[model samples]
Target: MDNFLETQLHPAEICVVCTEPFSLSHQPVALPCKHIFGHECIKKWLKSGQGNSSACPTCRYVVVEKRTPRVDFDTSSIWKALCDQPPERLNSLMMAIWPGLKILWQRHPSGNFSITEILDQAVIPALIKTARRTESPQDRSYDPVLDCYNLVAASWDSLGRPDTATGLAIAFVRLARLMSTASATLPKWLTSTARTNRLLWRANASLGIFELDVSWDFIIEATNLEEEQYFPLLHLYTVLVSQSIAHNSQPTPWPTRRHDIMNLVVERCCTKIGGTFWKGKPSNKFKDVLVAVYEELRRYQLEKGKMSLRGHDGEERVVKGIWALAGWTAKKVEVR
Candidate 1:
C-alpha cells in the first residue's frame, strides 16, 4: 500500500499547517470545529497528557485525546491560515464544498449517512499523516479550503444523525470564536473574511436555533454595520423554520413570525444587485432562497387557485411556493 502523504499532489494542495505534501495515505484528523490536522498531531497532543486540558491551539477548543507514543508539532498556524486564505482560497473551499453540496442537493436528508462514512474512512485519514507543524502565522501552509470542507463534511454527518447537530453546532461556533480571538491578537491576516463568516452563519442557521446569546457578539463583529441589521431577523427566520417542522414528530405551531421574515428575505432578493447576484444561481441562492421558501409557504395558505389578490389567504401567500420562480420571471421583464 502507498503512503497517504507522499503522493504527487500540487503545491496548492499542501496543508501549510502540517508542512507536508497532501496525499491520500495517512488519515487526517478533525478538530471539533472541522479543522483538519494530521492524525499524528492529535495523537501527540493526546500523549502530552495535557490531562484533557489540551485545547486546540487556534480555537482553544478542548478535546480529550487518548494519548500514546507520538511527536507533537505546534498548531499555531491554523488560525492564521483561516484568516489569510479567505480570498485567494475561496475557490478551493468552493471546490471541496461543491462536492459535498452536490451530495446534499441530490441525496440530502438521505444520502448523508453514506457521505459521512466516506469522509471519515477515506478523506480524513488520507490527509492526516502528511501534516507538519507551523511555528508562526506566515506559513502559506495547508489549504484552508480543505479545513472548511471538513467543517461542511461534519455537517453532512450531523444531518444523518440529528442528535449530533448540537455538538457540530458547538464546534462550529467555537471555530468562529477562535477566529475572533486570533484576529484580535494578530490583525494582518484579515483578507477573505466574508467567506468564513458566511460559513459560520450557515452552520448556526442549520442548528435550527433562532436566538443565540452566545453567538451574538461574533455575529455583530463578522458582519459589517449595514449587514448586521439582517442578523437578528435572519437568525429568527432560521430558528422558526426549523421549529415549524416537527416535535416528537408532531408539527408545532404555525410559524407566523417565520413567514413574515421569509417575506422580507424574498423582498430583499427582489432587489436587483445590478444583476451581480441571484443570476444563474440555484433556488437556494441567498438572494432568492426566501422567495423559494415563501412560495412553499403560500401553497399551504392559498389552497391553489381559490386565492384572490384581495382575499386574506389569497393575497397573503398567493405565490409563496412559487415566489422565487416568479421573482426570477419578474426580473427578466424589468431587465428588458
Candidate 2:
C-alpha cells in the first residue's frame, strides 16, 4: 500500500514539485499533504522538523519523514491522518492509535453494524453532553476554541475507553458525517469547517466541530487574526518554481537561478497585492493575487514556451441551506 510515506508504483512520472521526471531509478515520494515530488527534493524541504522549510512546499502543511510514537495520544496530529486513509489501512491506523481500539471496533462489526453506527451509539451522546457543559455567559479564555477542544479531550478521557487520539479523531470524523449535511439540514449552522463540532457544544446550538459560524465575534477574529498572510496564488507560484530546481546535493543549495526568479516574482506579486489589499478584509487579497498568479504563469509560458500551470488547481466550497448565524470566538467580549 502506497501510503503517504511511500512512493507510487508508476514506472515513470513527473515530480510536480521539482518538475523533474524520473524513471524507475529515482521515484517521487507521495507526501501526507497529497503532493508528490522527487524523494531528495522533498527531503531537503523537510530535512528539519523545525522552521519554515519544515513543511510541504506547496501548502505549508508540515511533513515528517518519520514520526516519533506519541506517548500522550495527542489529538491534533493523529486526527489529521485518520481523517484521510484507505480502508485497508484502517486496521493499522487503529493499532497505531492504541491497542484498545480493537476492542471498541469489534463491538460494532458483528458482521452487521457499520463503524458509523458504533460511533453514533457510543460517542455522539457523550459529545452532546460535553457541549452542554461549556455553554455559559461567564467563560473566558485567550482561545475559546482551544478551550472547547481541551474540554472535549477531557470528556473523552473520562469515558474509560482507553483509546488513543487517533481513535477519538476517527470517532469524531465518523460522527460528523451523520449530522444534517451542509447542503441539507445543516446549512444554517456550518461554514467552512465541519458542523459536528457543537455536538459537543451542546444540543445543536451550532453543529460541527470548531468550524466558523461567521457571526460578530467570528467577524472580529477573522479581521484581527494576526496569522502571517498566506496566499495560495503566491504559494503555488513559488512552490512550483522552487521544486522545479531542487537537487539532492548536501545542503541542497538554495538561491538557484530558478529559486531567485521565484522569489522575485513572489515579491513583485505581493507588492501588487498589498496595494489592493481590502483594508479590512485580509481574505479579499486573494482576488488580487489571483490576477498576479495568472499573469506570472502566463509570463512563464511565454518565455519557456510551456506554461507551468500544471500544478495549479481551484477548489469550490458550497454552503447550503439557510445558515444559522452562530459565533464562537475566544476573543474576550466587552459587555458594554
Candidate 3:
C-alpha cells in the first residue's frame, strides 16, 4: 500500500532514483532500454558511463553492446602465400576477407561530416567489421550503435553543451533513416530486429524529446516541413515539457528575475557523458551534495521559522530554505 501510494502520488512517470515516491510535479525520463528510472537517475547514469554497456536490470536485457577492435592476421603473410596459389585455390580466403575490406572502405574517417559521418564512417562500420561471420543471417538488421548513440546523446543533453550532443544525435537519426530506405541489405551477424521495429522507432523518438527541450524554434520549423523523421521531432516536444517542470523548481532572485545573471554556469550533456561522467552520474553526486545541504537548509529553515516567532534570526533561515528548494526538488524527482 505504501509503495502503491507513492507511485500514485508521484505518478508512474516520475524518476525512481532517490527512494522518493513519484510526484505529479516531477520530470519523467524514458531510457534506451525502455525501463524508466528518475530523470535525475537516468541523467546521471548517462553522464557516468554506467549505461554504456548496461542492460535492463530487471530483465537483464542488453541495452548497448561494446565495440572492440577486430583482430586481423598479418595480411602480408597471406598475400605472400597467395602469390604462388591460383586465384581459384584462394577463393575461400578472398570470400572471408572481402567483407572487412568493404567495411574499411565505408567507414574510413578522412574528412568533415555530420554525426552521420562519425557513426557511418567510424563507429558502425567498425562494429560491422568486428562482428563474427557466423553470428546471424546476412539479412539481419540489428544495430547496437543506435542505442549507444542515444545513451551518449541523453547524457550530453542533460549535462550541457547541447550543440555537440545534438550534432551526435542528428547523425544517428539521419543514418537510421538513410539505412531504412537504402537498397542495400543489412549484413549478416547483425541480429534480427524485426520484432523490435517499434523500439527502434522509440529509440529514435527519444532523441526528439531532448531536441525539443533545447529549442522550440527547431520543433516549430520541423513541423512545418515534410519530414520523415517524426520520432525525433515529437521527442523534442516531450523533452521541452519535462525540462519546463525540472527547471521550474527555484524562484528567480528578485534582481535576477528581472535580469539575467552574467555569471551563470551552463553545461550541456550527451547520454553517454551523463551515464559515465568523470565518475558517476551527476544525479548521484548531486543527490549526495544536496542531501548534505538539505540537512543544513532544513534546519536553518526551521530555525528561521522559530526565530520569526521570536523576532530573531529570521532572514538567514528563509535564505537557506530558498537555496535548498532546487536540490530538494531534484531529490524528490530523481530515482536511483
Which candidate number maximizes TM-score?
1
The whole-model lDDT of each prediction reads 0.38, 0.35, 0.35
lDDT of 1: 0.38
lDDT over C-alpha atoms for residue 159 of model 1: 74
Q: Worst ten-residue run, lDDT, model 3?
A: 258-267
Superposed Cα RMSD, model 1:
21.8
For candidate 2, write residues 132-245 as lDDT tens digits.
Answer: 233322232123223334544565556654333233434343333222121122222232222123221121112223332212222223222231122222222232332232
Indicate the TM-score of model 2: 0.20
- Candidate 3: residue 65 Cα off by (Å): 36
Summarize candidate 3's per-residue lDDT along 61-119 as a digit string, tens digits: 65545434333223223223323444333232223333433454456422123343434
Q: What are the models' TM-scores?
A: 0.25, 0.20, 0.20
Assess candidate 3 and give its lDDT.
0.35
Model 2: C-alpha RMSD to truth?
Answer: 28.4
